[model samples]
Target: MPLLRSRLLPQLQALLDLLLPPACPLCGANLPQGPDQPPLCPACLAGIRPLESPCCPRCALPYPAEEGTDHLCEPCLRRPPPFAWVAALGLYMGTLQSAVQRLKFSGAIGLDRPLASLLADRFTDQVREFEPDLLLPVPLHRDRLRRRSYNQSLLIARVLGRRWGVPVACRSLVRTRDTPPQQALKADIRQRNLQGAFRLLGPLAGERVILVDDVMTTGATARECSRVLLTGGASAVAVTVLARTPRP
Candidate 1:
């Protein structure tokens, strides 16, 4: 009975697909349903602009110039960040930007799977090299979490952790204060805004951690969180975000 059911399941799915094709989550384009059907349509996938070279290797900041080699940006040179580096799927614009905003602000949590899959696909090699001990999502203050009813970062982290076979620690690092939203603040003020906002739940034993977030703009939040994690005895930290706010 089990073997028969397994064989019939694919045929049943195929019949259903032929009757009603699935649509892309980002753009609503009709998708060809199959075992290998992508979560997003091809056009939407192409629209996601990758964070290319000629940018800061440390922060993944896209350079204004059209072309050059990856190098340290001025900020990294002047004041090094606590995290070793950042890995992102794409710049926060176009399709990627729309997707992030929808997932974050519109409560479209289903987007987490596709976004995390893309990030994992892009950085699987780098992650393997980093060999992080755990995946940690930047936490939201309880107040905000209560209002939103979800932490987008945590959702993404859960998906990535499962995909990468890494353990996820949801409460290892937490937002102790409900800091004002970073998007509304100036770049310089962003860091100040997040100062002492996060706290490590407990000491670590030199675990390498991959900090996960939905998007990164000034990186102030990531920097502050990394500082706490490092101080709490994490050996090293690397940031992974779905999108990076492109420099204007």
Candidate 2:
């Protein structure tokens, strides 16, 4: 009976799928009927544009035009961030933005899987090349964590760590103070707001760390966290995110 049930399960699932078609989370479009396909439909998935070359090597900020192989944005040239490098999957717009909003504010925890998979696929070469010793998610304030019940950055980091065979140190870095949302503040104000906002829980001496997060706007949050990590004895720090907000 067990063997018969196992053999028939796929057929039963197919019937159910036919009766109730799956919908794309981003656009509410009908997803192609396939057990192995991602929850996003092809149209919605295509809307998430991947980041291309000619970006700032230090911050991964997309440039207006192709600007040779290696270049630095004005901010990086004037004052370099604490992290060595930044990599992102795509510009923060279209379906990518929608997905991030849903995962972050709408309590869609399951979105992390597909988002992380896309992150890994988009930057597997870079991650392998950087070869970080540990994966660190930007820590959230306790109050916010309590309210959200999860850190989206940590969720993405956990998935990437599993895929890349890197160990995740979720507790090593922590947000010691609650600060105003960076998005709500100007670049300079954002920097000031995050001052002394993070603390290192343990030694990261001589370690190469990769900071993971959902999105990068002005990069103030990543900078602050990287500063803390560096001060705690990390040799180098790199950043990876699901999306990056293009500069105006």
Candidate 3:
């Protein structure tokens, strides 16, 4: 029966594909027919610009030139965030931004697979180096979670954990309060809004955790989450996000 099921599943998937057809989530172009190719077309996939060298070693913000010096961003140099470092897949722009929006706002949960696969491939080296003991998705407030019916971060984190053989602690950290959207607020205001918003549910003493989120704008949300985790006795926290909005 197990062998029969394995043989039938592909035939079923092929039938579904032929019936519904798959289009690129970014551009609505017809995707190539195959199990090996990502849901995105070749052009859309090519447009994803991975963050490269000469970036802030702490924040992963791209620098303009290779000055031969690894310098921290002004914010990092001054106040310093709670997280030890950040690993972002790319800048929040182009097809990447579009894909994120669709998955986040439009209820396109199916996009999770491709996006997560992209992230895993892009940040495999950095994530391996960090060697976090656990993966935690930045939680959504109860109200927001009910309204959205899902946490996109958790979905992405599940994929990463499955692929990397890391255990994901989905409920270890949670949002204690619902705040207004951060995109509309200034950096200082964003920080203020996120204050006391997150809480750690279990002890993380001396454990390294990786926080997953869909996007990092001012880094305020990640900062607040990291603070709570550290206060709960986590030795260190690193952030992993799909994209980073360039500093204004």
Candidate 4:
């Protein structure tokens, strides 16, 4: 009876799959109806390249070999960001951009694992370099969280935090204001828009905090969060993000 049931299960599942087919994440091809693999087609997954070598020491952009050393981007060398370090899971590009947008805007919470897994692989050493006592995802304003129903950053943070043995603090920071989207603003305007927007939830004195976020465009958000954490008495702040858009 056990053997029969086991044999019959796949046929039953296949009938259901035929009724309701699922699509591949990258190319929208129909996913096979079984536990053989992930929803993304193997061919598509193989073509998806992660940024592996001679990349930017900070932000992990694909750069020339000679330029990536010394652990500083040209911007960091000239005017260092407030956060001591930054790390990204992969270089942002075609399929990655779409995946990130889906996670952010289309309620594709399922993509969190793949994204976080990539980040975990890339930041192995940098996460250690910062030596955070805890991971704190950037706080979403109450209004936005209500509309979105989830903070994507926190989702990724939970995955990576569990793997890295670092505790995630989902409530240690509060968003005191709901500012306009940062993408439309200039650099100074972006910084000003976020000013006084974050506050510590409680005493974080002497705790080195790692701020996790989905994307970094201009570093304003991370910088703002670091300012709040530093003022709140955390020893230091380092940012971990899945992608960083190259500044135009």
Cα-based lDDT at residue 20, candidate 4: 76
Extract clashing residue pairs from model 1: none
Top-lDDT structure, candidate number: 1
Candidate order by lDDT, decreasing, is 1, 2, 3, 4
lDDT of 4 by residue, 142-209 (tens): 99999999999999999989878899999999899989989889876888899999998898769988
> Per-residue lDDT for 147-192 in model 3, tens only?
9999999999999999888899999998888889898887779999
lDDT for position 81 in model 3: 92
Q: What's model 1's TM-score?
A: 0.96
Clash counts for the predictions, in order = 0, 0, 0, 0
Per-residue alpha-carbon lDDT of candidate 1 for residues 1-248, written as tens digits (9 for 90 to 100): 99999999989888888887888888788976666888789999999999888789999999989878999988999999999999999999999999999999999999999889989988999999999999999999999999999999999999999889999999888888998898888898999999999999889999999999999998898899999999999999999999998886
Off by over 4 Å in 1: none
Candidate 1 vs candidate 3: the lDDT winner is: 1
Considering every candidate listed, which one attains the maximal TM-score? 1
List candidate 2 stretches off by more than 4 Å.
1-23, 28-30, 33-36, 66-70
Each candidate structure's TM-score, on Cα atoms with residue i matched to residue i, is 0.96, 0.88, 0.88, 0.78
For residues 129-224, could you state the per-residue lDDT of candidate 2 as single tens digits?
Answer: 887999999989999999999999999999999989999999999898888888888877998999899999888779999999999998999899
lDDT of each: 0.92, 0.89, 0.88, 0.79
